[model samples]
Target: MSYINPVLPGTNPDPSVCRVGSTFYLATSSFEYFPGVPLYRSDDLVSWEQIGHCFNRESQLDLSDTDTSGGIYAPTLRYHDGTFYLVTTDVGGQGNVLLTAADPAGEWSEPTQLDVPGFDPDLFFDGDTAYLSYAHGPTLAETTIKQATVNPDTGDVGEPSELWRGIEGTFAEAPHLYRVDGTYYLLTAEGGTHLNHMVVAARSDDPTGPFEACPTNPILSHRGHPMQSIKATGHGDLVDAPDGTWWLVFLGIRQQGGHPGWHQLGRETFLAPVEWVDGWPVVNGGELITPRMTVDSLPGDGSAPDRAAPARATLATFDDETLDVAFEHRRNPDESAYSLTEPPGSLTLRGRTESLGDSGATFVGRRQAHFDCRIDTRFTFDPAEGAEAGLALVADERHHYEIGVTRIDGTTVAIVRLRIGDATETVVETPVDGPEHSVRVDATAEEYRLSYLQGDKDYPEAVGTASSKYLSTEVTGNFTGVYIGPYATTGEDATSPASFDYFTYEPTADE
Candidate 1:
């Protein structure tokens, strides 16, 4: 179904959708946020529910010190012979590995290494033999496509085989290979992954072609459309409806606030109908207002919210499973490092040496959803040794906003400031009576003011503020989403416990 905005907002890109019977599952490429890839489920593609994560535990892929925008790239999701599989490139350094599961709801198998070169791999299984479609080298730099036969049963590649390169213009990265009837179709993204992006398709009778471009190339796009809803559209996947109808799911940006182009939600999944006209797929041809389409014959039979997010005032006591859409680390996530079965109700985040600037702490945060939002958290110190919990909007270490909580001589004080590149804003410190303190901040499209509630009382204590000063795609550009997570900078003594009662995100309830 066509969604008003991002059904799952904030920095979710390179979305890979797969249908298992009536159930639909989606996974996105998470660079730097460890646990590698996150898996989501939906009965109706419109309202999505995050079930469980694929890399909930370690052993899937190795992640450590991989900087923001490092590690994983575009990943492919496919269902073959009763098993669900995800194959991806370690764009940070190591190349490829394939992980599988009996069911998307179950614990995925340990990642199986694949001997292949290139990043942004998409998997297509025509039969028992599976094919991985990828753009090696640098997608923009290479402007090429490659394929290899992988045994679905073993998750191993036959050999590294070369496919056709993009001789024609507007045929670059995000290569997806589709076989229709007796012909093979290779769909790709061009003009980069932003505004100028377009979907181009080529075909050949052979899987390894001498492929020919379709007459109506760039089958779908909003290149010069009148509507401001769609821009930077590309990196898509195709799937068949239960009734045999053909549709395509691609990423698009919907501007929020008065800003109509730059997006906080990196790329959202958008759908358009495709009809095979003369052996070629046609996507929203010659249309200025590319309308949002639907798959169901009738809308939901009442009783369900039209994509309503649960009402939230504070982050603690949150019950939506707290899905970490962009949580990844150097090694696989250790369930024990942080326990889901915490003090019965609260989220217990163990103090880890996950360095601040050099690396980062284990974190899971949603993409920034609005021009303004607030983040609040409560954590205690270990008397002699206190931990640092940073509430931030991070693109990387270079550009970030950090408000740290630590113990000074046994009393708790809060320090908040803006740190950009090498410059700095005077760190503001507020004294509190208890060792545990409640911190809150007001962040706007233009301003970010950090303040704390004195001893759980909601009022302005000694405050610190910064003009959303570090907010600029040009200054800290990584085509990424902003996040709110807890960190530990308590030197060594890693055993010091840091329990974040809860972390809250408020996207401006009213004007």
Candidate 2:
């Protein structure tokens, strides 16, 4: 059977996996997005479904004003005894917090804020004793991996002990401790989270060890291999399948357009086979990851595709009381700012003082999973004097493109604007006589085209276009993928509301 590289695609990065009985559960980072820490479950590993978010309730998580790529760092999902534990760092919120649930898909308890003073927290349970491993450093260049014994029931932590500081490269973080065959093995991702990322390992006979680095340090890395499609490969977790097979689930990016390190889909979850050679773990036979891999099939599972394909053609209608799992907000959104049932079949978003460039914007979006795709939405708004409401494609606070309708000089107008670095420019502006309109943004490998439809017009007219490269990670120097969705701002009281009819995303046929 052949499976895809990104078992879970899009912005699903910093993956951590664990097995409970025959089912496998995975968690990934949801930086600056509400309902943080997206969880997925799979019986066959090849075909996965989003189970639920760990931080679903407002009380469970608070990411208010967290900068882009600042909230919900690397998360480690592990099942101990009969309970599921998810430990992670909330960068700009409550520091380190631990969550637990009886069922992986059920509601998780409110976070237990730990005293740990670092990021990328992992929980390893050996019998009744539990250990917490994390990365501590003032900056990425001086980071160090540390560990401490902890009580799972209480948030108390023991004295921190220094562990391996990585054999090569800086930012040696995302540490996972495991006991294999009567020996302790510590795995870490170093060389930063950029093109030079790599995974290295060290082993000892004790949990807190006088560890020895593997002679073949950096056992897995795609660095220096520009021709390879997968780059910046690291931050992996290992799990043993029910069939007694070892698999490595890690984060990697798929570049396009002959670009060596340019990626718009963000870091995605990738899977590869793992084997033990001379008591050391070797991944993918020490080879660069490919887009597809052939593997053994699960015994009775046949829903998996012959090959993994990119996500395409999705429609999100606000028909239910709750938003879909794919929909995400900038940060901790105001509880009173959005509603799905108020208008019945429409998503009503109330404008606020926050703008797209602010930390707490009333914006909802999903990852731009595909490079070549079209995103369109129908919205109706009668804005106040200074209110603005419409759609946006965002890379970060400083880099984004927006198509919005605002009241300018007592007239409702549709405008397309672009923000790059410290400069902001309006690409197109048109008067909208009516209160309702449909806007669309089509993205190619090179540029993005903004268009709209008014009244009963059968075709959308082009409003403006902008270069796509300016909104890329290479240009912005940010660690997030692009998100497309609706937004609203009133510059003050923010009492005006915008009603969205529906949102649709369609990828090009060749994507």
Candidate 3:
């Protein structure tokens, strides 16, 4: 069977996985997005469908004051007995939280605050004894993998002790422990999370151990291959399939052009094969990970090409009463600002005083999973003097590209705005005839083109273009990818609301 890399694309970083019988469950960090951790289910390990979010309610997650990429960190998903447990760190709010559910796709229990120190929390069960592993310390130089016995139900934790410090690398974190054949193995990611990132392993007779480093350390890395398409290969978790094969699901970013070029889609979740040699694990037969792979066997039939039941082409008319699981808001949104039945068939956004530059804005976006994709939407907005509503491609609060219509001097105008670093500028502005207009943004490996359709025009005219590198993590110094969707803001003096007719996201063939 053959499948593509990045089984989970877009901003799906810090992937953690576990299996139950023939089914596999995975979860990833959501950062500042409202729904904290995104959960997925896969039968073949190649195709995955987003089942639900662990933190779907406002009470469960609060990102109201979080900076870009400052809310939820790495999450570990594991199944113990008949219940599924998800443990993660809320970077800026609650320290650490553990949540459980009987059904992986159903509603989860409320957060059980754990007294664990550090982020990237993982839970390992060995015959009713629950052990927790996490990265601890204030600075990267002092960072180490710490393990502790914890009561998963009562949120009580024992004192944590240092495990392995990795094989002489900085930021030794993202630890996952496993017991195979009476041997305890601790795998970790080191060398930060950029081009220098790598995966290392250690083994011992016990979980908390004076462990010995693997003979072949730094088992998986693309650091030395500076120009490789895949870089920063680390933060991995291992799952034993029912077919008696071991698989590794990790996080990696795809580089576009030059050495350490740029990746705007964020760190994606990738899959590779694992094999045991002697007493340690070897990844991909000692080969570097690439964009595609062909394996001997997968869990189920190799017929899962359309991963999440909605791939390539996505259209939402807001006909349903609630938003789809794919749509996410920035932080804890004012739920009253968004509605689907206000006008019966359209999605309406009641403009807030907060702009895209602030948290809690009236905005909803989907991840830009593919490098070459287009997002199109049509909306009607009669701005109250300074009000504006339209589409945007956002990286964070201070970095994004927007195309919308706003009233200027009693005339409706279509405008394209670009925000990079600390500078904000209006690149294009044209007078329009009515309140309704169509806008779209086309993304390529190198740049993003924002366009708008004029009256009686068959095709959208290009309004402006921006280099994709400006939105990358290297440039923005953040841990999030870009999101494309609709937004509305009143800008303090206006009170008009915006109504969107429909939205579409389609991936195009890369050039």
Candidate 4:
């Protein structure tokens, strides 16, 4: 009956949950990655599976020019009357979009943009009336939670009224509205998304409330426990178990190293039991969250895939036409820039004018879920004058490490490039006699090492090593985790296609 924390790991942040019958569905933010909003299904709350994505097609969402961490933010998933509704903000693109699907695992309907002003949008259904609650801020220092009545079908919204301005935290966001025992409750995350994050609530008899703050505000937070592994606890969603038990799924980060936390895997989903005390919700019995716990009332057979394991290992041959759910591109990828069938069994990526630092670049990758893992890829590229293609360990546009193949002096060579903040340096450059050669990136807890395969041997030649600390959230000051994947870029009109024969990622046992 024991379950580990991070029910969903590695950048799966801003989790929202809803129940349909005995089944539960959870959705998380995808940021700038295309096929956005990863959805999961769990029969017993302990075992979860990726069912589908909410924004799987361009018609459903267009993140073409959105910046990293700017696409989809804080999606609120709710099931109502045989229809599943997803409401969220696009941050830099479309403001707020409402989408619906009959089945949570199937195709969602076209989005209906809402006229709401801010982010972290939530929807609550009561009879024929639907209510929308979202965050509104004049400045980050001063923010307010607001709500309004809305037509579910037409996206028409009534006038919004202030619900709560937050008790003490600066940024009050991620609002979820729930009615328990005929009393409307408003829960929100505050203290921003950093180490001081917390979940607080207010309740009233009316949906649009003159709400009273929970006397014991910040029902859940790790700010007081600096030594605790789980930090930044907030942005919670409540759900009722089949047996009438209540559970809360919230976002939290595991900080490694010393205090004044540093986290790299980004915000992840964590589960906690909830109890109703005097008509108010208390999370994890109003205590600091533990990394592992036993849920006696809920069944835990441990059949679910281990979230700590690398998403994929051995090989990703790109033989199938569809990209795996684990693979994601930066922003909306240019369809013409990538192909699976052109060369058959290999992923062909055409170089573009955009660099890895720019939006809409030709890059696709998976999360670096494990701190100690080996990621390698074999590719053949005949670059045009100024084109490059290779493997990248990306923290952000400005902070990443790349070992790529590019043409230099009429010869193709494997080069290791480092981009930390405003500095960019080429640390290694070795001539590749053939077009097909395997490049490997190995990451330990301390550093990331780059190498190349020689004569059928794995990583026979060493390139160099870079400190992993540079790719952490503490150094980048970004809200995303690192992604290890392939990238291709060109200058101006130059176009070069790089075909990846295969890619592999295996986590070390000790890590």
Candidate 5:
């Protein structure tokens, strides 16, 4: 059966997976977004559903003031006995942390800060002995795959020992250790997470390896293939199925536009079949991955009972008892900034004095999973003098394109604003009469079209456009993708709040 490359799409990078019984569980890097380390469960490897986040409470994760792409790094999910352990690095916070849960879908315990000094921590248990391996050093070029004996229950780690520095590559990170039969295979991603990203392997008889590099060192990569649609293919974890088949789940970015084009959806989770050949695992018959591929060894009847449709869409009315798991806040958001019960059926966002250009901004958004998509929202915001509220396509604080309503020069106006780097501009503005307004943003691989409804008219008037490439990681130099949702900001002494009636997101057919 053929399955999509990104089984879990949109901003899900540095994937780590573990299998227990007939089910597979996966986790990925969240990076500066609240409720960090998204978790997923799958019956079939191709179809996954979000169970919950590993760090759902503010007490578990404090992303406040963390730099862009600096909060959560690579997470390794492993299951031992009946307990599940999740270990990861908070690049700009409390360093490495360990958390466990009896149920992956239930609330996880608060973090236990590991005394390790590295990123991408992986936990491996051989019977009762626990081992922790990670890419350690002060910088990428100096990184070495290191392992140490660990007490999983108390988070006490013993002295570390050096493992392999990657073969013919730099930035050795994202290490996962597995004992296949009697050999300990160490898999690590090297050459950074860009065009040169790659997955390399080594093997040793001991967990603290004086190991031998695989003859085919880079078992998986798309390093030199700039023209391929799938880019930055690395950071992989191996999972063994109950059918005795092996698979590798990795992170890759899907490029749009032209050669070495821009990717605005961030790094997504991709899968490939693995076969053991002469004691070493070969990924997808030693070939790079693509968006569509056939996995003959996939489990189940090629059907996912609860899997989302190919073209995913969502319509949220903010009438639910709590926000959907799909929605996330920027940093540790002011909980008081948002309300679903204030005005009964509407989602109210109290404007913060903080602008979208800073952390703690009053913004809640979902990852932009599709290149060709449309977002339509109806909102009412009586801006206090210089306040503004509306929909936004956000890459980061400094890079975003927004269309909303604001009061400028005492006139209530609908405006389209573009913020790239240090330059911010209101590209289009038109006077509107009422507080209630409907806005729309249509996104393609190349650009975003901004429009708004005029009065009681059925059609929307065009309000300029912004280059999607400018919002890409290639230009923004961030580790995240585009997020589209509602936002609001207030000036001093502002009293009014922006209340959103409904939000609709649809992946449209390409033009």
Candidate 6:
């Protein structure tokens, strides 16, 4: 009953796990992935369900014209004192913003920006003083670690002082500071976040001081790839299991080919045991843990190891809402920008701007990765002449591809095109599948292939090489993640508004 693969499927990266009581909560930095800061709750660290999102409205975080990597970056979710704090760096030129809520499942407060200079921030609270530990931008030569006091009331960062810088080019990023048994332990992600990624630790008597690196520097690493289920292991947060055992949860990439960068399987969440031997934390035999078929222990409910269909996975079920976690924005969107209630299950993506480059369309997208996926759309493409209703593999304005029913002339035409940055290349153009018809876009990732669904089957006989290349965190400039979404575009060429009867995304059960 486990997901067996991709629990947080399709570009759910930068996962930060926080266990509130017996309920385990996980949040990922949803760069342009809208409804920013996706929050999922699971009784067990495994089996999870999407309870809500952090940015519920546009006013909180804007996403209009936001390029590929423009939105939110690495976020740290922590339960301090009594409130749940979700801190993130909005690379969208908005600086860093922190939002808080009394309950993880309740309404969250608006984000308060910090004049801070770095990204991927983690907060530490001690008594009345709060410290924010983060390091991203270039260091003073060594890896830079900055520590600053955070205001509890406004979530504003105070004057920051330079903490220790790692000697290696690798900086102390994703730093988590905690005090245990009279010592301040700083747990940080080292070796960068890419290839050499690993969890490193150091301890200091003071919150800010000359720290001593752990003898076992890399407390955890996924370097061993006998079958390499977790790759690029780093950026971790520590937690105490219900049984009182200490553990660390971190994100790692799972690569298929040793060649690297064929198809980024993705950065997945992984947990490892932490042994505190003589004040130094040793993780999984002093090396990163290898992937396992299943976690041995049960989750909070004490359920058996997953006979449940999908653990910690987000399921839309064509429900009342479009599974908020599965959405993103051009610029930040206001509640009025889109609607899930009007047609209920049918997501009506109102057009924000006209041009394809900057227009804010309510594109409910998922990551474009699948050995096989079936996405059927019953959309009414009756908008102004140029408005578009189609499914897209959106990386950015520059790098994107889509096949959809666009209202052309007096009728709807099926258009296929590829856009990489400012330049666009049209794959082909066909007159409609017929007016107001059911069009589906099916993409298979095996050979990095994609195709359009013509009727009940993969459509029009066009299969493009399936590549997750454009979706790479390296190529696409935006901090935002890429998604495969069904979009409705409105421009000056439009006549009336279009509404979709429904859009269903169901990957092959085994995919």
TM-score to true structure, per model: 0.84, 0.94, 0.96, 0.94, 0.96, 0.85
Compose the digit string of candidate 6's lDDT tens values, residues 132-198: 8778556622457888998857867788887756636556677788787889888777776666777
Q: Cα deviation in Å at residue 434, candidate 1?
A: 1.3
Q: Can you tell me which runs of candidate 2 are displaced by over 4 Å?
A: 257-261, 298-305, 309-313, 455-461, 491-495
**Candidate 2 lDDT:** 0.85
List residue ranges in candidate 3 displaced over 4 A. Answer: 302-312, 458-462, 492-494
Per residue, candidate 4 scores C-alpha lDDT tens digits across 279-348 of 8898877778886766556633345443231243546889998776778887777889889997999998
Best by lDDT: 5
RMSD for all candidates, in order, please. 4.0, 2.1, 2.0, 2.4, 2.0, 3.6
For each candidate, how many residue pairs have backbone atoms clashing (under 3 Å)? Answer: 15, 0, 0, 0, 0, 36
Give candidate 6's error at residue 500 in angstroms: 1.6
* Stretches of model 4 off by over 4 angstroms after superposition: 299-315, 457-461, 492-494
Q: CA lDDT of each candidate? A: 0.64, 0.85, 0.86, 0.84, 0.87, 0.65
Q: Which order, best to worst by lDDT?
A: 5, 3, 2, 4, 6, 1
Q: What's the distance in Å from true for residue 26, model 5?
A: 1.0
The Cα error of candidate 4 at residue 295, in Å, is 2.6
Please give the distance, in angstroms, between residue 10's alpha carbon in candidate 3 and its true position after superposition.
0.6
User: Across residues 305-413, which tens digit of lDDT does each residue of candidate 2 receive?
Assistant: 4756446456988898888778888777887889887789999989888888888788899888777888999988888878998889888889989988888888887
| Model 1's TM-score against the true structure | 0.84
Candidate 4, run of 10 with poorest lDDT = 305-314
TM-score winner between candidates 4 and 5: 5
Screening candidate 5 with a backbone cut-off below 3 angstroms (N, C-alpha, C), the clashing residue pairs are none
Error of 1 at 89 (Å): 0.9
